[model samples]
Target: MDDLASFLRNRRARVVPAEVGIATDTRRRVEGLRREEVAHLSGVSVDYYVRLEQGRATQPSEQVLDALARVLGLDATEREHLDRLARRPRRRTKPPAGKVRPELQRMLDLVAGAPAMIMNHRTDVLAGNNLAALLFGRPLPELNTARHLFLEEDERGLYADWDTCTLDVVGHLRLSAGKYPDDPRLASLIGELAMGSDRFRRLWARADVCARTHGPKRYRHPLVGRLDLHQETFAVPGESGLELVVLSAAPGTPAEDGLRLLAGFAAG
Candidate 1:
């Protein structure tokens, strides 16, 4: 499970002193908003806010989240992130039918230059080639990526920026759940993660939502020291539970060399 305290600490650290208009006094001990200050700004009791920051509050309402977002000066993206952390419930419905079409798999394979993988709303690795396996570790065809990250021990070592990746994974899941509220598979995945990983539970409760689009990713490959790549997701036309992700690096950088080495490893 992810450490909620750690997540909160990271979020708290990202807000600069200037960003919040809090002049840093010479005697200030804490870097960001004091617990009492945050509580006052959010209109909640200091004790309650402290507990929430400590990851003790099991659930927080939308109003509280909105207040917290306002006080924290969260952007639209960050406010949505806070909501995801506040609103994830415990009970779960069945998961949606999470299967990739054969034609989609063929199409994924046809993207030979860029490493690609097919994933469902639940982040299940449905299909991919040897290159994908090498890049993302062996495909967890039966497991959701969130589960692998939070429940599996290997994930911490696998993802270079685990916290950022966690945000992406959870945000994508939130978006999918919002888009398909009745999707049984997605619901089940959320429930399973919540039950199995306290960190996932904390994040889900915040109610963050994001569409997985294009982004830069840095990976510390087990075999290749470090590589930075760009990830792009393409929606599959007419397919409900599948999307294709492609990873690419700039043509002449060290990242390209690492990717080429990775491809060669896959080829062998």
Candidate 2:
């Protein structure tokens, strides 16, 4: 099955009996909502929903998808994800190689106070400012973050909370992979990581998916020690493959001071 179908199945399995007002009966054969139950809640016919889950149906109407989202109790991100899946044209086309446009590079350079980097859907660091290099410890010229996390030995040392960070990376990648299953680049990256890193293989097998657009991130900088920062990712308009990520620290904090110091060091 494709990623979307598998994801829906997994999510269905996760909503427990108590959460949806279902009884905890040991006699129940299935782990989650029955196909009929989901169809009922989604205002769709059981056969139609089953066809959707089986990857036989495509192009579900927005109203039906919204109903499904409501039935699934999806958050804002999850709802958008479902819509994307429903609206996705039937094609196995690969994503074009993601590149940072000159204007985006200029924008990154212009942001002097905050460290910024442009990353593709595959989490490849296409470009970054000097401050970003300083903060992330001078990322290798052609390194992809997903590859570095799974294959590079130094990744654990760089990310203080290695386990949590690694899981998050893997989960996020899995989500992206699901969204763009036909992308050869993403497939190759996942295949290589699965073969090389047992940890990545295990995580991928779990089928966990996540979308972290904005959040607090803690990093152990080689030069600045532990630094707590907020991270936000902005999609570059008119650019399908590029995303700009900016990191900032709270004002009047040690992290802010460290960031300033690091920026100065980068300049020097």
Candidate 3:
């Protein structure tokens, strides 16, 4: 099935009818709102909704999208994804070259006592500082973070909560797929993960969407034991699809001391 159609169907299967004030009964065969029910609630005709799910209606009006989004109870990120999926896709463009600018590399090196790295939409680690290399226990070049989490046995053990981390990463990739529908590399990466990992396949089918901007992440490092750090992501100016991620711990915390130790190790 097409991405747009599959996305709508997946989301439709998740909304609870009672949560939206529609009474539920055992007679209901589907798990979530039925297609006709969605049409009625969203102020659209059943034929149009069905056409949408079949991927026949490509250009939905803003009013229609807004109504569907409300009925589906889509979050801000999901709403944006819905809009993207509804619009006509442009011609396929070449994926980003995944090159880290010399200035950006210098910036990564200058970030003190923290692990910093640059990544693209596909989680390709374009570049990383010495501390980052120590933190991940692997060289950053040619490392796809998503692949590491799902496919590598040793790397999977680093996350204190691996399942949640993998889910969030999958959601981020889903959002990227919506934006860059024709990116062959991104498509290949998704296919590879799906074929290699059952967990990835399950999460990918959920149609979840997310953006990893800032959050606290816990890691179980061989050297540090447990390190809790907050991640900050910045989009590189003038560079499309590139983000700078820096992981730092709060002041005076044990995590901070662990970072200091890691920094020393990097220095050594």
Candidate 4:
């Protein structure tokens, strides 16, 4: 219920009245469309929408959800996310923390071009090749990607573009929370970040969700200088929510040379 309310509030903040062909006034104090505006646009009573956003009412029906989604300009992903939130919360069982399969580790070993890691839904780095360990730094699990960005002091210098990285990391965490709302570890992680970082709290409040399977990322490695890696994510077959993330540069590129240098340095 709380997640549903938070999602609605976040969506509301991103929409503007005038942009959606509604009247606007400077007298308004809120950042985006008000409750009444959304209510009106969706053809729902203000009291009903208020109760819905406050999480005081029961789960909204499909008709109501469709109306809200349309009024809020939610994309396919966001619309699906909205549906999940609006549904009644289900009790979910947590699986044991998993190990990367032997074959997966072997595959990682064979990938000599770049850093690679196996990550779980909660951003725990289950296993990593030598290059990933050297670049991300340190022991298993402690190097949780989201935690590194929000809680680690040196992380500010590790990524060339800290803001973009944090957005992606937070979005990753937010998406996981929606999928595994009952996971205590994830809840604890979110609580820790909320306590530790005002910036994190603000971003988390936006309630965005993104999964970057393939993308470019900038890093400032201590040994290799600037690196621009094209990252790829693959889901482990027969493994739920396990992703193999590989970061590589094109052949003969400076970034590729940097990875080769770092791999050698990491070996020693």
Candidate 5:
């Protein structure tokens, strides 16, 4: 199925009918709301909704999209993704990677106490501070976070909750795929991961989408034992796809002490 159709089917299959006030029965064979049920609840014709699922109806009006989003229980990020899938041209060439601005690199360097890096939509680590280099075991430019998490066996041991962390990574990549539908680099990366890792393929097939803006992450550091940090992400001003991510620990915590110790290692 096409992306839009696939996304709709996945979302439709996930919404439990009873949760949405529809009475459930044991006789029902479908996982969630049927196509007709969605159409009726969303106030659209079954034919139109079926056409949407069949990829024949690509452009739905704002009212229709909002109704559908409501019915699907899409969060803000997923709602935006649905809109993008409905509106943007299906194919576009992503430009070649650009160098990180000197000022942005400087900003990373100035954040000496924590690990900070810049990445694009495809999770290509564009630049990172020295501390970040030490934290990730390589400079950001040398890493694609998704590739590292999914392909590298040793990388799994670094995250305290590997499954949860990797799930977010896959979801983030799905969101990116919605934005840049035909980005060859993204397609290649996804294809490679799917071929190389069964876990990645399973997660990708779920059609989940998410944005990891700010969240707590726990790391199992070989040197420090355990480090729990909060990550903050900011969009780079005037830059289309670049994001700055910094990881910091709360004051007076063991994680903070560990980071300070790591900073010392970075310095020497």
Candidate 6:
């Protein structure tokens, strides 16, 4: 129907068969749990749930939404987003989301030993510093972080914890979608990813929403081998659509040494 269908489908795929004590079969073909399975767990009619997912059903009551949320095990943010989407009468288009500021580039470059970049809520890598370029490789035609994460083959090798990165990307995009449901580019990006990668499509359906300002990350650097770094994300004052992300390591740590090595080897 709209994002609701996608959300339900995605959330359904994330549930484990045994999670609800359902027996498993290797022949099960659907991504997470089947539509009938979710309906069964939520104690709703399979036909009604199918209509809801197909965008044919009327607005659901609070109890129904709560039941579905509980069945899917949605977190607070995800549950709230679902409520908003369900209440919305129709979809309206908005302009493309915000862009990176010129100052972002200058700020990104000032950092010495860290990999730093600016990205929009849609995970578009608008600009990055030399160290970031060295660490993550250079530009792409699309310059979208999620695209690079899912579409690029080498990305799987670059991140030591690829699966964590995948979930994080999906979660961030889900959060952004919830906040700006009308943004055209965001919708387009979501559709593109859903069409491009099965893994991406499966994750997108799960309705996970997260925005982590700071966290630990692991990367595989050819020069320094495995590097563990902390990522800190800073707001740019005026834009909800853009933020600054910097990756760093504690001083004297091996990851710090890797950052130093990249800086020294890449300076112009």
- lDDT of model number 2: 0.76
Q: Against the true structure, what is every candidate's RMSD?
A: 6.8, 2.9, 1.7, 2.1, 1.8, 4.5
Off by over 4 Å in 4: 90-96, 154-156
Better of 1 and 3 by TM-score: 3
lDDT of 3 by residue, 1-268 (tens): 1277888899999999999888978887888999999999999999999999998887889999999999999999999888888883644435566788899999889989989999999999999999999988988995888998999843348888787789889999998898788888889999999999999899998989999799988899899878999999998888878899999999999999999998888878
- Please report the TM-score between candidate 6 and the true structure: 0.72
Q: Candidate 4 lDDT (Cα, whole model)?
A: 0.82
Model 1 local distance difference test score: 0.72
TM-score of each: 0.63, 0.84, 0.95, 0.91, 0.95, 0.72
Poorest stretch of ten by lDDT in candidate 4: 88-97
The true-versus-predicted C-alpha distance at residue 103 of model 4, in Å, is 1.9
Q: Total backbone clashes of model 6? A: 4
Model 1: residues with Cα > 4 Å off, grouped in runs: 1-97, 153-156
Better of 3 and 6 by TM-score: 3
Candidate 3 error regions (>4 Å) = 90-94, 154-156
Q: How many backbone clashes does candidate 4 have?
A: 0
Q: State which candidate has the highest lDDT.
A: 3
Per-residue lDDT, model 6, residue 163, is 88
As for candidate 6, its clashing pairs are 10-205, 10-206, 11-205, 13-32
What shift in Å separates residue 59 of candidate 6 from its native position after superposition? 5.2
Off by over 4 Å in 6: 5-54, 57-72, 90-98, 140-142, 154-156, 181-184
Residue 4 lDDT in candidate 3: 78
Tens digits of lDDT, candidate 5, 116-169: 999988889999999888877876788998888888844458888788888899
Residue lDDT tens for model 1, 180-235: 55676667778888888877777776655577789988778888778888999987
Evaluation by lDDT, superior candidate among 1 and 5: 5
